[model samples]
Target chain A: MASVVPRKSHNLRYKTLMAWLFTLPGLVVQLVFGWLPVLFAFVVAFQRYYFIKDPEYVGVNNFKEVVADPLVITAFQNTLWFAFLSVGLTFLMPIFVSILLMEMSRRTIRVMMILWFIPVASTAGIAIWKYMYHPNLGLLNGILRGLHLPEQKWLDDPVLAMFSLILPGIILFGPGLIYIAALQNVPEELYEAAELEGASFWRKIWNITLPRLRPIIAMMLLFSVIGSMQVFELPFIMTGGGPGYATTTVVMYIYSLAFGAYNLGKATALAIVLFCAIMIMVGFQRRYFPENIDESSENARS
Target chain B: MPLIPQVGRRRPKTRLMLLAIAIFLWIGVLLHLFPVAWMISASFKPTLEIFNAPFRLIPKEPSAASYKLLASTVNANGQSLNVDVFRYPLHIYLQNSIKISFLTLLCQLPITAMAAYAVSKLHSRRAAKWLFYFFMGTLMIPGQIAIVPRFLLLSHFPWPTRTVPGIPFTDLFFPSWSFIGTYWGIVLPAAFSAFNFLLFKGFFDTLPTELIEAARIDGASELTTLRAIMLPLARPVIAVTGYFTFTGAWNDFLGPWIILMSEQQKWPLSVALYKLQWALTSWQPSQGAMDPALQTLISSGVGYNALMALAVVESIPIFIAFLIFREQLMKGIQIAGLKG
Candidate 1:
């Protein structure tokens, strides 16, 4: 036993050295690109970065400028509005679609996902929608005309532009692959027992399905909230923050502030503000939801 | 097989509800597929007929003219007349897209996998927990926060400052390498995804430690154990992560847009598609004269058709990838380990 102690310690020491060696490459990369830049965000937010000049400390001036700009207010309002609309309009559509898809056989679910998940490049999708939203020649107006309904300025109007950005999401709604996975992970016995208790279809779904899906739904909600708050590409590509500040999200504002205006400091400051906003939402989600639900639920699976 | 068991189908009311559900799903599917269908239709149609009265799902002309415009190898003979040269001649950008996506996978998979494996197996438990956090801490932060800093970092490598600081007590400066305007700019930052690290780690943790113990007893090094035994068993995780990495890299716009924007030759399909769409939409026929680039597209017998054709071209690889990885992903996030 005494001899075994030293040998075991020696083996552990050797393994630890090998482990560090294996981790070296990833450490260097994660440090350089991952860790440093995250810390650097705060540093840049407080400094003035010029194109060809050295960065100078300008304590809180960038944040002050962000607060002073009226357009920044508009961008934040639009971002919040976009987030609100995304949650109300698009968030539950996946769950709803999955529930609807759940009524079908497993084979149908597989086939539908195969077709549904074949997504276009996001830019391409945006471009397609942009064309379809064209007031004069777009298909949406044409469909409106064909139906004898009033043709509206789909994207040209400030009121409708945000809606138009969300229109594709509503139209392209389908079951999320993750939601389907979560649904499948539910044990067959739960439903079998529910059915034996004379539970109706809707009863089974409400009692068995949704509760089982709660963790995934909770996590997805947090992700969706974070994602919609930082909505950049959709508005950037579709409207170009167009028809006034209607679709200019906060992240889009940061983009223009950084690249278009070449004011990196202010952009980083706005980005940090956006980060705080997302973190607050995430914090709320963590507080409300059991984040380690899957771990608990794993014992229930086959 | 589903929430509604097969035996329930015999009940009259249940059959009706199921029928209604099926109809609802089918309608959703059609609405989802309409844009893709229209994209294909417009790509094959003549420009006038695209917006013509009585909208058609199938093109009347059904010509390959727009595809020809995209596939054209012809240059602005000798003088390089067209200024918006990146607008057409699609193969170069297609190749660039493939290069960026593949190169990103090449760098990302091994690096991220090795780190995840080390955390899962080789490291002491206490150290592994901290190391896991070191790699994964980035996942919680909104990625937009670091965009400005990342750009600055890349523009002057190894320095977050655009201007490098001098070495203390010496006239010499720290060595640096700029990745801006090069493929490395995109590849280097994307090489270690904390998300993939999470996936790989979860997978490794699931495997019995006894396998590693056996390998070690046989005098295998940690690297060899990973390569010889662990990796072969990790095929499902690799498939899921690799497919994700490939698709993420392919669909990416902002990274390439920021890094390789100025270098036209380095533009991937995402950037090129954005440029093409911007050029296509910037002009209106009702407004008389047009940009020379628009005129070149017009002379070639298409307008927005080129953009549609390009969209189809861009989506092909993703669709092919979906086909190849269809089973792995559709096995659901259960197998993908995305659930946790």
Candidate 2:
């Protein structure tokens, strides 16, 4: 027993060492790329940094510059409008699409999902949309002309530019992969019971499907808000924030400040501000839609 | 028998509802496919035909002129063709994209799998808890905050500046290497994904500890057990993680854009596409006409067709990837969502 005890302790030490060995490479990567850069965001935000010279600590001057910049206000407004419109327009489409998809036969569902899941690279998708929104040579205008309707500059006009950016999303709406997955978790018996109670399809959906999907919906909402707030590629490619700063998102402004204007310190400071805004938005969402669906159900079951 | 009338009456109504749904879904499928169809068709059309035949679903006269131009370095008239639209030949950008994405996957898979294995299987409960937090803490912070710092880090690799503070003879630091204009700058930072780490750990947690214990009792090392047992059972998670990582790396725009901007030869398809589109859009007679030769090419519809062709080229690899991993991907999304 004593001999076994010593060997067991030795094995424990060996396991610990092996564990550390396995974790080392990933730790180094996450630290150097992930954590260190995040820490540097704070440091750089407070300093006047440029590639040509050493960093100089300036007391909130970068933040002051960010505040004074008029373009910053425009960027914030555009971003907020984008977030509100994108979420408002596209959020419920997925939930309803998922519900509608559930009504299809199993084989049909598989076929449709494959058709839906055909991967479109982000840049390629944006490029495709760019062609579609081109005023004179675009398919949309051609369709409009064919219908004997007047053509409008989709991306060239300020009022329609942001809408044009989001129109592709609304037009091409399909079931979100995550929402479909969540919808499948709903027990079949609940629907059957609702049907036996003479509930209509909409009634069953409203009662059984929606409540069950609340947690996932809340999660997707948070993701949508975050994603929409940081939208860079769509506007960056499609509009170049065009016609007149119509689609200049906050992230795009940061990109220009950092890379275009060569002001890294102010960019990082704006990034910090964007981070705080996102956190506050998340906090507000949590207060309104707490993720207690599973816990409350489990408590009821107990 | 009382239920018979109720069932009979509901049958036609149910059929009507289903038929309505079918029609709605078909419309959705058409709307979803319209733009993609246009893109593929436009890629094959000549530049003049692209603008002229906007309503045409299929190109009336399909031409590979855009592709040929993309492949050619000189025109038949013995004049050097300007490749500045894409900044390089099509294949060079394709090669860069493939190299960057593949290298990132090569590094990412093993590192994430091993770390997940350690946390899920090797470490004690308290130790695993702390380690998990250490790894995932960054997930809470918005990635945008780190962009500038990360760019700075890459510009001056191994150190953020030319000299180190408090170190004498800093000028002799030969080990420092700048990754700004290289694929390594794009590849290295993406080698560890916190999201995939969670997926792997969730999968590893489901694995029975007895198999590992039995292997250990049979005198197999931990590494052997991981390689032989865990890896074999983990094919699903591996496929999921691998697909996500591959697609993420492949579709990455901003990373390659900012890092490889100066080095045109290193620009991936995404960045090249952006530059091409920018050049195509920015060139107007009123906008101080950039390079008369390039202006002539743009006016000839070469720019439009080439851009569409490039978009097609960019999408094919990922489309093939999806077709290959369709089942695993669907299952993975479900598992990721549930576990997350």
Candidate 3:
């Protein structure tokens, strides 16, 4: 032991050098793509930046413009409304379905998961939905006609447009693969124990199952909230920010500002505002939910 | 054990509950599957028959017309319109998607795994903590904030500003390469993903340190230890991360759209699909709003049916990938600490 002590210190010095060597390529990538791009965002946010012109520092004028724009307000309102709708319509539906799916036989669960897991590329899927929402040639309208129900212009009408956007997710109420994986980790003994005392199904779920699943549920909620705030592609593709401005989300407005009008400074400012808003939401969530990543890994190990 | 006890499953009340659950799940599966079913069937149906009343799942008179159209360079009139955009045919876009996805995986996986391994095992504790955060800090930040800046950087890499930096006393400016129209623009930025970094680190952390130390003591070089010992053990993590990297690269729309928008021949299947959909919507089949150039194409009877066929073509690789990585993906996420 005495003889090995000096060698151990020397070994650590070697390890440190080797570690940096191992890290060199990833370091360059993160610097180029991850860190440097983010650093430029702040620089652009503060300056009257366009690609072709010299950046002139404008001292918060970009932020001032972002705040004063009525469309910015409208985009925020739409984003908040979409967030609320996503919570009500789609959020916990996966957890609830996965719970019930756990009560099914393994064979049925396997078949259901495989079928549900089949991929339709999101752009393709959105286009498929676009075809379905077509006023004259769509299968959705065809179904409405078959049932003798009045056909509504699904995507064209502003009133029902956002609803139409989320309608597929509501119908495609298949259990999430993540939820099923978490549900499988739930201890059956807890349910069995609940049964011995004459607990109902819902009661067993409340008393035993939920607490076991709380960590994962909290994390999924955090992700969905962050994800929903930056909802761009669905609305962008489905309606191109709509017949009017009904579907122009925050990120959609940012896209228009950057790519559409070429006011990249203002666009970056608006994006910074969005970034702060999401960070605040995440702060509150972490405070309340207190997700422990280490604890979940420990549970998995045991 | 199943959450619902097998013993109680025989009881009448339990049986009814089971019945309800079965019906709910089956309906969910079928409802979700209908759009996919329609995508495939619509691809085969004749264009006029696609809009026919009482829409059927299987085309009554199925035809491979769209598939043939997808294969050919010329329109149904056999007039080659190679000068027009969207006239490059499907194979070029498919090839671009495969190329971009392959190159991204080739660059990203090993580069990220090496960083993750260093942070997880090799570095000193204090250094590990800081390096981990330096790499993982982007996890909380949404990537969209940098879209404009990233686009600018790609147009003239390593210089997001209007003018490239010059030496203080010299007239010469730094050399800059434009990545905007190349596959490198997409492939390079994707070489580091903070999300995948989290996944790799989580996986590497769970691996025993003693095994690594033993390998080192046995005179194996750090690279050899990683290549032979750690890599074989890391197959599950590699497969899971590789699957995600491939899918993300395949399905990515905005990146390719921004980078390759001007270079029409470089567009991936995602960008092509979006263009097709946008085109179809703008020129509603044989309508007055249609451009005459597009009107000819629409008149050739390759409208929504051809779009559906393209969509089917785009989704085939992703479905194939899911089949290959189905088990690892589901099992690996639990190790990702999503499990409770």
Candidate 4:
């Protein structure tokens, strides 16, 4: 037994060494680019960073400023509003559409899902939608004219710009594919048994599918919050955070602070705040709706 | 009664109803595709026809002139709306984009695959789990948080293959291969995709253990076992990853915008398009009398056409790649389930 123990210990040591070696590159990268920057940003949030010079420490002053500043306060309010509304819309639209898509055969369902999934990948779809929302030459304006309805400036109107952003926000909900896959996995026998017991279609869906999908839906809701919160490119191209800051996301604001104003300190401060908000949101999600969803486990095989 | 009727009266009625739903779905799909159709139409029409009220679905006349002009036009005003001589040629930016995307694919795939294999094939579960947790935790850190630091890190670079006298090659090799305003900028930032690593690792994890055992028993090294046994099995995942990396690097505007700031000579197509945003408004009144605003409007159409044309051109390769890899892409996405 002692002899066996030594051999086992030796092998375990060797394997551990190899494992560390294998993991070193990713760990180093995560530390340098992914982890350290976050820590640095956090530190800088309390300090001040000036371009072409060293940072000077200032204890909690930046946070005080961030909280007290009217712009920051407004940004926080606007961000929360956008997040809640977009997250609600993105989450619900997919489940609703998936149910509608579910009323067809598996073949048709697959085609529709693919069509929906394509936009999640291709920026072309977003570009196309931007052109469609153009105030003068865009299709939406054309349609409004044809119908003799009011033509909106769309992205150019402060009141309407955020709403304009919402159109793509609604059209581009891709949670449907994941939802469909999850829906398909619910054992048919359960549904058949429900039907045999005289449960109506709506009742079967409510009881069987919704309960089964709680974990996935929870994760999707988290995804929607994180995604809409950090969104930059869409508004960057479509509105440039105008008509007058209505569409400026927190990320865009940070980018402008960092590059445009060259105020790395304020940018880092904003970034840390954004990061904390995300962490808090994620923490809330994990607390409220925890899952043993090894989401990546499904990534290995189709 | 038959448990599952195959073409009885009730089944047919149900099938007919489903078919009706399917046809209705086709209409919904068409409505979804409406914007894309409109974009194509706008790209083809002349300036006068584009803004004509009650915008015509069918153009009065369509022309390929916009596409042709964009493809060939070298010197055009960039994104600035109020500046002349602020323009750079699209071809240079396009070339830069293509160069960077290709290299990004080249560097990212092998590095990620090697790292993935290492993670999956490692003998210790504790180490593997830690690596995974570390990688996955990166997902929660909003990338915006890292942007400032990363930009700072990139600025202190001495790029494109330099040598230091004493040290091992990698450190010196690295700063020389620095990631600011160059192709390496795009490639390096993107190289460590934790999600891709997970995808690759997941695929490697599912491989038959016996094959690795046999290879090791035959005295093959760990790297050799990976090369011989694991890689061939992971071709589908790798191909999908490659396609994904290509598309992402091709379309990304943020990295370039942050890191590459020397305008005119140093920009990608996306940056060029962004710079060209107000290029139309900057047109000077041809040193003669005419409503310069009217002239500006006409020129603005040309610029607008150019921008849309760029969007179309950028999208074609991706759309074609989609058609080619439809099955694989679908299969890959279904598995990966989108981490970002």
Specify the highest-lDDT model's number: 3
For each candidate, what's the DockQ?
0.65, 0.57, 0.65, 0.36
Stretches of candidate 1 off by over 4 Å are A1-7, A288-302, B51-54, B73-88, B284-293, B337-339
In the range B56-159, model 2's lDDT, one tens digit per residue, is 87889999988887765555465564546433678998898899889999999999999999999999999999989988888777889888988878877666
Q: What is the TM-score of chain A in candidate 4?
A: 0.86
Query: Which 10-residue window of candidate 2 chain A scores lowest in summed lDDT?
Result: A291-300
lDDT of 1 by residue, B2-64 (tens): 877787689898889888998888888888788999888888887777657427888887878
What is the C-alpha local distance difference test score of each model? 0.84, 0.84, 0.85, 0.67
Candidate 4 displacement at residue A133 in angstroms: 2.6
Alpha-carbon deviation at A155 in model 4, angstroms:
1.4
lDDT string, candidate 3, B1-340, tens digits: 3567888789998899899989998999898888999999999998778766327888888988887787777875678643243578889989999999999999999999999999998988998999888898887788888888888888888898767789679998899989988999999999988888888888888889999989988999999999999999988788888998999999999889888988998999999888877877875444556587667767777778988999999999999999999888766766765412
Considering only the true interface residues, what is the Cα RMSD of candidate 2 after superposition?
Answer: 4.0
Q: For model 3, what is the error of residue A143's alpha carbon versus the real structure, in angstroms, after optimal superposition?
A: 1.1
**Steric collisions counted per model:** 0, 0, 0, 7
lDDT of 2 by residue, A209-231 (tens): 78788888888888889889999
On residues A1-302, what C-alpha lDDT tens digit does candidate 1 reach at each position? 89999999999899889899878888999999988998999999999876766789999999999999999999999999999998889998899888789778778876777777777877888888988988776888888988999998987799999999888888888988777767777889998998889998789877788877887788788888888998888888888898788999998889888888899999999999889988988888788666575654664574
Q: RMSD per prediction, one decimal? A: 3.3, 3.1, 3.4, 6.3
lDDT of residue B90 for candidate 1: 81
**The 10-residue segment with the lowest total lDDT in model 3 chain A:** A292-301
